[model samples]
Target: MAEEDTARHRARMQRKKAVIEERIARASLERGVFLLHTGSGKGKSSAAFGVLARALGHGMNAVVVQFVKSRSDTGEEAFFRRHPAVRWYVMGEGFTWETQDPARDAAAARAAWETARAALTDPGVALVILDELTYAFKYHWLDLEEALAVFRARPFHQHLIVTGRAAPAALVEAADTVTEMGLVKHAFQAGVKAMPGIEW
Candidate 1:
């Protein structure tokens, strides 16, 4: 009876090992080089930051440029600014609705895009995070043609993460991986105020 039990266990183990190996093989063949538009949910920028953390943990060079809501008070921005491996740049603009100035917003976005473009071309930078970049495109503050050019011309192995709501179709098509975070529920809708570390 013990021998039969041992044989059964060994068979199950072999089958599990085969399944694992198959998954690994399939994953190894998948290579992605493009944008990640994480919008439609509140965690879009947060997810991008998660990727930045992973890149920094691995000793890879990373750049984060926050476009809208560029306050330095955010916990993530505060922590990352002190890290030697990360280059952080803030466009330093309040929310678009708050600003109520189209010309100023466009100028700010252009400046931020210039910084991002430089980061994208830098061979030392393995990852570039463009936080709230989609808003610039959506508002027509940044030229879409030039933006697409930069992405296409980025060095091989370099990855970009763009976060904001309502990502354009062209940007989506250009991406190798696209994740749309749908809004299932939000506490803000219930008149609950945003708290630091959770909403900010």
Candidate 2:
């Protein structure tokens, strides 16, 4: 590289580092955060599970509640369930279309919420992942006010991760951090089947 180019790059990096350091220094709060991941794209729940793994590595206890997923055989569940500090629950009968029963789905959502309530109230749990929970609000199976109340009342140091598509506006407003995954191009749309170990 030319001398001028090298000097310019070094100056740009120095400026960037200054800005980053200033921002980091301003962020002084020390407490758990509520993160919501929602969108039409995939990997919302997967990302939450990844965070759970990170928390587990730090020796933090966690609870996972899978709302719209009935399968208990996923790779994440298989691996995380082995940990003594992790409490995993698969609390769905199946997808709505497969179940074909609104009443049953509502009941299942309520039951799952109850289990999640226990986790949220427990001070020992450091992280709680409510996987696919947005569907309950989208389908009107769970009330927004009730959920907001419970979320507000959860242990202050407990980090919460709620993942699913079509997240309600109120929940989005309540979250400390929100991520919306955008679908650019999916292999499934191009006749590529979802393979094991990748999709699960």
lDDT of each: 0.86, 0.95
> In candidate 1, what are the lDDT values of residues 95-180, reduced to their tens digit?
97889999999999999989999998998889999988889989999988789898988887788888888888888988888888
Stretches > 4 Å off in candidate 1: 1-20, 26-32
Best candidate per lDDT, number? 2
**Cα miss at 195, model 2 (Å)?**
1.2
Q: In candidate 2, what are the lDDT values of residues 1-200, reduced to their tens digit?
A: 99999999999999999999999999999888999999999899989999998999899999999999999888999999999999999999899999999999999999999999999999999999999999999999999899989899999899999999999999999999999999998999999998878898
Tell me the spans in candidate 2 whose CA falls farther than 4 Å from its real position.
none
Each candidate's number of clashing pairs is: 0, 0
RMSD of 1: 3.6
| TM-score per candidate | 0.86, 0.97
Candidate 2 at 25: error in angstroms?
Answer: 0.7
Error of 1 at 78 (Å): 0.9
What's the C-alpha lDDT at position 90 in model 2?
A: 98
